[model samples]
Target chain A: MGQRLIARRQSLKYLGMLAGSVAGREFLAAWLPKSEKAEPIRPTESSYTPLFFEPEEFSAVEALTELIIPTDQSPGAKQAQVARYIDFLVSAASEYNPALQHEWTDGLQLLDRLSREKYQRSFHEISAREKQMLLEEMSLPEQDSGRTHPGYKFYRLLKEMTVEGFYTSQVGLIQVLEYKGLSALSEFPGCTHPEHQS
Target chain B: MGTHAAYDVIVVGSGAAGGIAAYVLTMKGLKVLCLEAGRMLDPSRDFFTHKFPYEWPYRGEGKPGQYGKLPQGMEWKIKEWTDHLYTIPAEDPYALAPGSKFTWTRLRAVGGRTNLWGRGCDRFGPLDFKPKSLQDGWGEDWPISYEDVEPYYDRVEQLIGVSGSSEEVYNTPSGKHLLPAFNPRCGEVLIRKGAVKLGIKVTPKPLAVLSRIYDNRPPCHYCGACNWGCDVGARYSSLDVLVPKLSRQKNFELRTNAPVHTILMDRSTGKARGVTYIDTRNGLEYEAYGKAVVLAASLVESIRILMNSRDREYPSGLANSSGTMGHYLMEHVAFNSIEGFFPQLAGRPTSNDDGPGESCLYIPRYNYGEKDRKYLRGWRFDFYTGCGMGPGPGARFPGFGSAYKKKIKELYPAAVQMGGYGEGLPFYWNYVEIDPGGLRDRFEIPQVRFHTTSEYDHAFAIRDEMYGQMEEILKASGAEIFPYEKESPYPLGSVTHEAGGCRMGNDSRTSVLDEWNRCHDVKNVLVVDAGCFVSHPEKQITHTIMALAYRASHHLAEEFRRGDV
Candidate 1:
């Protein structure tokens, strides 16, 4: 699986440079190291245990995060272990920022309450289609006022945290986004594109 | 009381001004004793610039309650990664008026703010010295001219290894830079192209970072973490560049962690005897004597020392004869930034774009020579590429998952931002005074109370003009402007370019220091810091501070030769 991923990344880099995209060339320069390939370690769904959430709560958070950034052509939030990262963040927040800890607890409780009211079951047990419909309804603000639904505000927070957790993770940044920086370069490569010139 | 041996000169604060003063004075064969309030920091162990976020406990974003614990005025100074470089406000506190909001961003370390300064080493033009002459009713003109300080400016630039091409911009005077200029990235090129259409000249910014190996210091490795503290001696910090050189000289002696309480004065001759300071480690008071004293202890701190020094002859303060010890506190007021995405550079492959944080292009003050605006002085603009490292602002990117990831890559390289820094007129109302009701620090020394106010009409007018020009350039480049509300000018000291409080002029009643930066009342005492600045120009002040220190120290050496000091 690791070899296949590396091969795919190399091909994508080649195709990007051939098409004259600076982003693709940057990926090649940053990722194509001369040393042995060091594959990033990611926690499997089975191996991970929740520190902040209960088993049921963890299941709901995992389901919600995965749905928010579901696996398509590339690895998604589940592979990046965004739920576990969020659990770790919330667990640590209990000390300095108790308000942040309270926000997470209340937000999770709101999700549970909404899921039980609509489907008579927990959020993880709800059907994917039903989950999507419920999320769409939660996303919109009230008709009379500009304020959004409490559940929708929770969704926005969760989504923002999930995006941050995923993009910063090795799997997301290297494999998905292909970020290439923090290396010592002899010189910087300025813009070479003629189209960008006036 | 004087247990220590007498030295030729005693320099306070070992930052930019003090560093230059010590070097110049000692090199002239005068015995100098330098006292610093902060401990020395070893960059190799202290700097966390290259550390990855994952390696840190909270991913380099402070711990949950960490920010809440920071004191009100100090929260902006301490970033999660750079917290070690700043002083904890709870431990070292200052007072402010009830409704006033002033951000006194300070570092109590040996190198001071220079260790983590934005290395924008710009030279002040001829108009900066004579602001009253430029337009009436601004402020008093500087006693010295650009011609008087030009030679010292060139000497300091070469010693510090400034990198830039010479663009003959009138306000940003040219210098004999030591290194080649950095080439502009795609985003900067676009900015230049758009600015040309508006008849604005954008040239390479003169920075204090070395482009090539010079004077045994290595060139910048393009780490892009200049503010985090450079581990290698590539960037110019007094600790790295000046202190080590001064340490080699036999006449120079540096004492760290010795916070000066007051300047000891001789009552009979009215000359500065030396200084009495507390040992920060053991809390024991010690006095050091010298023939002459140079106050290079930053702007506010120097004024604090002077104000605290009260004798039978001068009850108010040591230099209160002019009554201008702590007045005319000025800071550069920065306006909101104009940021946008250049569509043409979208989806371009990324490379190691990590260079110094200094902008590749600098738009000098063009409002001068053609004064049609309501405001008196003008502003300058700086252009740079990249939205910075790490995960992008997820809140801006709507939606989640794979599609959002695609958008992040597309928008990453296209990021371009331009920030405006305008000149703030020095007002007498904005000043720092020792609290009359006895508010003192841990050392029992009285704390300073700041009362600062800006010219609202002039500030707002400059902001509107700058924002309008920025929008025109962004629109001309065919870039999508970010959705941001226009903001009011930042509060005083927000830019960390604080000046004045002890200004220089010909008149003794109006100014504290003379043209050569010597205190008017005391012949042997001199202030060679931002406090000597007559008018606060839009340009950065570190280069000028160092240049003035060298010029004043040279003058002091001449006086010593003639036995006038």
Candidate 2:
């Protein structure tokens, strides 16, 4: 993945020179799973009723969201109640955009079919390792140019919602991200660092 | 009070120009009736200022299943906030020609676009009025000069309270009564290295935000919600600054939802007698008489009114004998931006970078005096930093997981996007007219067919050249420029700094209005809005719009007092 990223950056002429010189270039870093906030996420329970999804589909969706942005030190999407939020959103918006309901139903149903074909079990019924592997398999075609894979497309859509739901929630924004905005500051302390100036 | 009241002057559209015109005219002891098509906006009630994304019902993307263009970006693909600020497209429809690329966003509030404006207060210099004359002479020049509107500029800055530093620049002149300027941020300070290397100045932007106390209005607390409407009345919105003062004046009266249909003309006198307007709430049309009529109904709307006001006396629309109405349409070329982040600021503790809710740095038009040029007119640079706005920078990053989340946290505060904007040369074919066969809105006013004949091949060439210079500025500052697919200016009419539908010039044969914004064909009619702008300088033009309207209103007042009409 790291080599592919470097090759892709180098392929673009404008990025060719920077790839060799800058050690701070993100592609040079290790592709290992080691990350900050590596502790397990204690996801808060939400008694949210699924609006669009059936009980089985909702459980599978909840699992997928957690896998995409799992809790480490802070709470994850499960704690943010993102799947329920998405289900409610799709159901409410069905009147205006009927295609959305079809997209979600079909996407989740495809996830079930793919899991059953691969492992002879539903997505939620699969092992934790099997779930991650299946998701990564869906994610692989995302980097490929021009080929719009439906499984990869669904993964991208799911990831977008998970990221949006997590980052916008109080658990994601204040608890984890430590956002410091919308405050009345008497004075804005701008660029006092000596190294940053010259 | 009677529904029909006789007025000394009738003003249309209460945004930047109409706001100033109402204040000036009413204060001049004239009974001014300001007609705003939009309903009143309550800042405290309507404004979604300082609101968290999670606080709203659907987390600021509006109600579930509502599909609209995400005001910014592709993903998270809905209104994250300030969606209610704009006029609904279905409610206010306009036509776009077959291949025309124009995205018109209108603010439905009383103050119009100023409620959510960036609050840039850049004053036009002496050379700006003669945009074409000073250069190789390709376009038209303003009927009025910077000298003719200098005192009005001084008056506007005094009333509005712009905070900026004197860089001693030529194009962006310093206002006489400016409040103290804000200190440059880490991103702004870092980018100056590239600007200095390129022999250009990056000065603190002249903004209408009050830095210190002025006119009993409190100074800006730097909450960074200017685009979402300022709730504290710190920034200069027409609702905050102009309407409050206008409310006190006994001669002033604001009639909301009264959209002006046409300028009612008396065939005998050969002058604008009054205007017929529809009261939106009642579905009834009424006539309001005035000694003089001020058409400050924005650039497109004011021109639409004149074009719709056809009669036996003046068939080619009122005051349009030259057939030059709706010609010479102009919009400032903007939206080509480079998303970048300072690698140095990565992994740093997050601090609030929303300094008064707008970019403080400005690379004013330096190529105005230069001999060589990339395109027709020069482009200026300004940056907007959206620090601590949640995972937006991470969208560009490949892959997702705990590592992705960690990377987003590290880079969230380091994000900054700088854009280049330039002067748009007036094209005669690029104009807005009453839609030949378009739907009328609820108010029964005919929709406008917005048209722009710009291929943007020249615009792309300008941006491509600008990218090289802007890239150098970013690269020198150790900022990683994010590669974006958007390589040209935003579709024309997207940048709300849209001006010029009825051009003002010395000759009535080629222009619509005279130097004082009064129509040459009809003496009593005046266009005090940006509709009268002959050409735009290489900067954000709302400040110049306010100054021109103030000067024009004063001229109208003088003319009215002298019984010139």
Candidate 3:
């Protein structure tokens, strides 16, 4: 019984270390019950047209941003319209910093190349399991600062834009995170918890 | 130019000093004309205090290339919200010397930087007046004392509507006109509890906020947007608190967009009888004459005006009889900052914790009377532990995907920030002068150039010690310390609390201004701003500037009654 408890504690420590990455999610899947993976939510068509990316490139960007901040318990990047925000940001960059626009275009093509090289499919045509694995592979160089591979650079840029676009949206800021600032109050009631007072 | 030649007094720059001079002088029934370098801001249109990130066109991140609008030497932080107050580069051009590194945060408008100030109204103690008498004897003592300025401080506080606790804190005077200070936030209480173990007293910051319905203004509703311009008259900006009432005085007149070019000197009397200024709207130069002229166009700008007013009688600069018009420049040492969070409060339910920004909690200078310290002057801390739960931390956090989002949500109410602001000894070499290269602004005025340094090792040592103590206090509260810069890496003028150019002295041979903030050389000219500050204190100086302006204007009023001018 002592030996089993020691082994369980070791596994728990490893689980905590890799819990946020793809590695621990797979580990948990083997033991814990597998949850349902719903169909990916696509943003509703509107009057908005892609200013920077082409029609097919926009679809791939939309798929990736939604994947980065997937809908689990609340609305994700799809509902936040993160892909449209990126297009707006990059398109506006065309006037002053054209290199920024080039980087986004090159980054999307690199992701497509990585998807085709590994899974024999385009980035938007990949399976959900294959997509997650590709993302996991692309993010390997991000863990090490010295590695400046093309895949790492592309993944970093896309992930950053995705985070910025999603978190600043009303759906993410107010509904998901429920930000507590930018409101009026008659009086501020500070830490009411007795244990926190010390 | 209506009644321009018949004014009793001409006050330049409608900011803290000029606003007070106009208010007090007009109350004394003197004809006062206030010349503002910038346009009159409509608070309903210009202020964006309650604006949300989603409401902003750029989502509060600022547009991609919009930062290029700020002039060289201007602060980058102003480009987002308060950029309208700062001057554009080519229009109001000022040069930085080849090796000099400074960020002069100049603001023009009826209210000046008061519209975007921290509003921490700390009064200098009795010791602050006689700094030269201290242990190391590094700087000169002010000709005026705390006793001489105490009554004026009281009046200014009452007039501006300050709110803070009346505490018997050392080396600090308890305010006589302060309203009730706000209740301590949770982070403040926790930090105070932690500081108790270290023998440091964390007190509620005395702020220029109306805590109650005082002087017909409604109380502050705690929006935590003080830096973004207070639209409601709850927070004290000179525009909201002083300008409206002063304008109602029949003896007063205000001219906006009228940037003063120089002090029009009377060669025979050797006194300033009028001012030459340019009206920005019509692009015309006009002369407005008065019995007396008050140079309250901020500290550096006042020096620029006096320097530009040079003639054959006093070629060095207009009141350069003592040769110290723009010498001892000092800014508060403020690069020592530590961001941390209490572990016990992590994952807790978030609340609207941003009660009063910048005026939350302060660890007052604890080394008031200590002689055994390694540093000459002491430092203080400004800590704000608001629940700034936003996308900002998520961007800074490592990783992405569902887990990253979950972590950000969990650590929502756990962020805290503490920074130390301390005194930097005035080195004689640090100064501001007219650019010898002869670059001029759009109005054909010689541009002011700055020369200063921040590589003061002794001052930086104190900044490092401040960071260490902050870590100790937070660790005592079971808080986790985030990574931060240990060394003092900020430039000299990062604080923008520049003081000391025309030093006030009892003697005329060593200083430009007399004890009453009047020019020792020119009898009718008064430099009534921080330009006459003898030494820079660790605390901010806007409160002191207002008080000194009040004292000087009252003394000028008495002289007017006596027919001395």
Alpha-carbon RMSD of each model? 7.9, 5.1, 7.2
Span of 10 residues, lowest total lDDT, candidate 3 chain B: B68-77
Order of all candidates by lDDT, from best down to worst?
3, 1, 2
**Tens-digit lDDT track of model 3 for A117-189:** 9989998788767776777667654343333455866776787677667766898778887766667777755
**Residues B1-565, model 1: lDDT tens digits:** 7544489999998888998898899999999999999899898888887775556666565675665555332443466667877766556777878766576777878888888888888899988888888655567889998999999999898778899888788767979655898766777788888888889888888889888899999988777777678888789999999888988988999999998989888877888989999898988888999989999999899999988997777677788788888888888867546555677766777544456556667788887654567776888887656534544322244344445555666666666666778888787788898887678977787888888765468888878888887788788766766545577777787777889989998899999998888888887889999999888888988999999999999999988888887
Taking all chains together, each candidate's TM-score versus the true structure is: 0.90, 0.92, 0.90
Write candidate 1's Cα lDDT for A1-198 as tens digits: 001011111111111111123432342343222322112222236666888887777776776677666676678788888889888988888887777677777888887688899999866677766666566557544111244566866776676667666666777666666655555767765666686675
What is the Cα-based lDDT of residue B29 in candidate 3? Answer: 92
What value does the lDDT take at residue B141 in candidate 2? Answer: 76
Number of the predicted model whose DockQ against the real structure is largest: 2
* Candidate 2 docking class: acceptable
* Candidate 3 residue lDDT tens string, B1-565: 6533579999998888999998999999999999999999988888887776566665655565555444222433453456576665534666778878666777789988888777888998888888888535867899989999999999999999998888878877868658988876777778888888888888878889877889999888877777677778788888998898987889999999998988887776677889999988888899999999998998888999999889888898898899988998877776734655566666777677767655456788887666666667787877666455245222334445677666656655666667777777777788899999998877787888888777687677777777887788888766665555465535666676788889899999889999999999897999998888888778778899999999999999999999998
In order, the Cα lDDT scores of the candidates are: 0.74, 0.74, 0.75
Kindly report which residue pairs in candidate 1 clash with one another: A22-B348, A22-B349, A23-B348, A23-B349, A23-B350, A24-B349, A26-B350, A96-B65
Best by TM-score: 2
- Residues B417-444 of candidate 2: C-alpha lDDT, one tens digit per residue: 6777777778888888778886688777
C-alpha RMSD between model 2 and the true structure:
5.1
